[model samples]
Target: MNIHKISAATIARTACLLLALTNQLLSACGKPVLPIESQTVEQLVTAGITTVAALVSWWNNNSFTAAAIQADAEYARLKQKGE
Candidate 1:
């Protein structure tokens, strides 16, 4: 299984995406745009936790898929060799 490590850059990118989405949703509701950094400390922590959870979920799903693909390839190789 090729489990890749998540980088700071990845986290930052996801955070930015989440921020943009939040802003868009708020704007759609006739609300003022509030950037993530402008939020209170509690809000910021909540956002950070949310972002991390999303990233972890994504990583877990991808890792499982990768492992499955790797296993399939190995099985194919072994079967071909046996044949």
Candidate 2:
């Protein structure tokens, strides 16, 4: 019966429907257009090595970040204890 309530509900429902349609379209478009052939054993091994190196680099960076976080937390705890 209230015009404001009706307009707000309509807008909310339209937004939700649009978001769902957009997600569906995006997912559908994300598939590769062409089929890929299987790689040779040598190619697979090289790819595996590359992946491992990348993972190791990521782990090193993450370890540095984690260590920094721990150091910061310890510093904060000590500051609080002193105060």
Best by TM-score: 1
Residue-wise lDDT of candidate 1 within 1-83, one digit each (tens)? 89999999999999999988988899789784774344585888889999999998887635358788898788789999995
Candidate 2 Cα errors over 4 Å, as ranges: 1-6, 31-83
Give the lowest summed-lDDT range of ten residues in model 2: 31-40
lDDT, candidates in the order shown: 0.82, 0.74
Q: TM-score, each model?
A: 0.38, 0.30
Q: How many Å off is the CA of 39 in candidate 1?
A: 20
Q: Tell me how candidate 2 scores on lDDT.
A: 0.74
Candidate 1: misplaced stretches above 4 Å?
33-83
Candidate 2, position 29, lDDT: 90
Worst 10-residue lDDT window, candidate 1: 32-41
Name every residue pair that clashes in candidate 1: none
